[model samples]
Target: MDTAENRLNPPSQLLLALEVRGILELQAFFAAYPLLRYAPRGDGHPVLVLPGLGASDISTRPLRTYLKAQGYAAHGWKLGPNHGPRDGVEAGIDSRLADLAGRYGRKVSLIGWSLGGVFAREAARRAPELVRQVITLGSPFANEPKASNAWRLYEILSGRKVDDWPGREAMKLPPPVPSTAIYTRTDGIVAWQGCREQYSPTTQNIEVEGSHSGLGHNPAALYAIADRLALPEDDWSPFDRSGLRSMLYPDPLRSDTDSEAALRVSLAV
Candidate 1:
């Protein structure tokens, strides 16, 4: 998904304004929210969480804690703050994926935020056999990688300019396993358009009403994560938003309605 082109960048100023919700995202952790109060328990699988650019595991602690409480063996990437795929960082992640799968003797699930989402997709692409599924929170891995509001800052922190890498093209499709892209219309870091997954049998796009930063803590998002992880290993299905949950989550498959064409244009870009 990392490419040299800047053909479709989002309104940088708008992204900046939307980023302010990052503060509210932090507040969710301190609030006495009723969301996710009874999210279904998981099958006690091992889940690996990755933070966004410039953030470390500390940023993911709240999400990881929730996952743990839901009976998942959640682990944060502790190899220091995310600064992009610097020299050994990518290798380390691959090794980590391999080790986790081998040790647990089961496929691993990965959840990543922003740039970390990009990392999660690539890892699955390389080793689908070891990966059960991937869930990305506001990751811009489908289209223009340099389109993020933080691309410039990513360059500064990563010590490398934005550029294409191996398997970037393959990212246009779902990784060799079940893939879910959890995005919002108001994402301030990267264009929400670029975060949508192409309509595919094994890929899905889940829409939530929260800032990109708050996605990890958003009640709707947490419940969706629980719903996804609860799926039987061999009977995967698209998100079910038939009843009251429909009010919480927009119809992700509502492409035949008014929002269809615009949504298509956005993801197609």
Candidate 2:
């Protein structure tokens, strides 16, 4: 028989439970509100979604489909599987952003998950005029390299040193363009502190109840994304806590330091 400690500590078991819980929560939230099905429509500027480290475009299929159904021109980063820092990767990202902007005839919105979020922010910083807005899910930006246990595994697999990677420096925010970062306290992968952003008027940090692996399918995250995308071109504002009191406790954006600490402790357990 498996001991309670062993069962709880096993990476596979814990990850599976988190994934299951995330799916159940998503179903319950969507079922409660039928009107939440509405997705933004029209030939709006393209929204490019980037997958996390080691994730291929397939991982983001659900999100892309949902965005398309909502009427937005959503696209995947078709640049092969994300394999960490590599030669020509940065240039490739620039080319993709430029191509999308030229084709759409407007600034493109970026929605990156995990490491893809880091890349999206960097692209926005490099060309703010060409980029309209950015949204990231469960990205780690505040902490230094090696902050998360998973980073060690990633480093070993990719044979690249994260500390030497330029992406780490690019995590810094650029000029204000409506930005929203959604994270959860129960994330079993990256530290929640890494997902936070501060010191910007247009930036928002939304705290949802979920695990990192299932953020793409979480109902609260979907609703939040829909809400942000639906906002009129000029009405983009920081996240407001007045309405979400029932959803998440203690607004995660109250203060960067406190929120980061609280989130870190919550996820450590």
Candidate 3:
């Protein structure tokens, strides 16, 4: 549940215990692989996948593979592990985005998980013309710097205080391109509230059910990603959750308020 007060703090430690469920989500992904064929296919546009904190391209291989099978030319960040925008990271992603767009003669779509999503959003903002769209998985972009359990680890790896990072305020605004934020309230790392995007014509917030770490491979998340990627270059629209789809992807607008009310009741009890 998300509330202004709760948003001020990281998710409860009890939630971290749920991260181990990521293994189960992985198994589910493989089990559902056959069904993934029914997912929407893309137009062979270039897509770049970025990994999360402490993760290398290796972590995004499964996702990239799926995207490739869908006919998109998916590429990894290829910048080693994501250690929170070290000296060359910002420049590296910029160069990669420019090179891919230039080589393919098309704007590149970006899919990033966790900290990688943070980078993806920033990259899109830095060069909207080079970006087709941005999709983020469990990335804490719209909340306070300390609203994540990994802030300490981020400080250690990036050698910068969580609050002192550059562009902390500007990053909250949606990029100029179509953007999707896929998140889970059951997330074991960052607060789910921070993982949302502000309402906009080109931006959306999608809620799935899973651990924070498994979003990259979570079947629901994967399906949403595929659907978003399949949209024609200029035909972008909000994700449709009519009929049966509503059962899978909750209405974040309603659910957020409902969950907050539920939390208030629970606290009062």
Best by TM-score: 3
Q: List the residue pairs that clash in candidate 1.
A: none
TM-score of each: 0.87, 0.80, 0.93
Clashing pairs in 2: 40-70, 140-194, 141-194
The list of candidate 3 runs beyond 4 A from truth reads 1-7, 255-269
Which residue pairs clash in candidate 3?
Answer: none
Stretches of model 2 off by over 4 angstroms after superposition: 1-35, 39-43, 167-170, 174-176, 248-250, 253-269
Tens-place lDDT per residue, model 1, 1-269, is: 33446366663564457567777866765573445757778888888898998999998888888888888888887779999888988898888888888888888899999888889988898888888889999888875756677888888887776764556677667788898899887676777777888877888889987687788887778888888887777777898877988897887666524333444476479
Question: What tens digits encode model 3's per-residue C-alpha lDDT throughout 80-196?
Answer: 989997899999999999999999999999999999999999999999999999999999988788888899999999998888878887999999999999999877789888899
Tens digit of per-residue lDDT, candidate 2, span 142-208: 5566555467666864688767776455565543577888987666777676677875778888888
Name the 10 consecutive residues with the lowest summed lDDT in model 3.
255-264
**Reference-based lDDT, each prediction:** 0.80, 0.72, 0.89
Better of 1 and 2 by lDDT: 1
Which prediction has more favorable TM-score, 1 or 2? 1
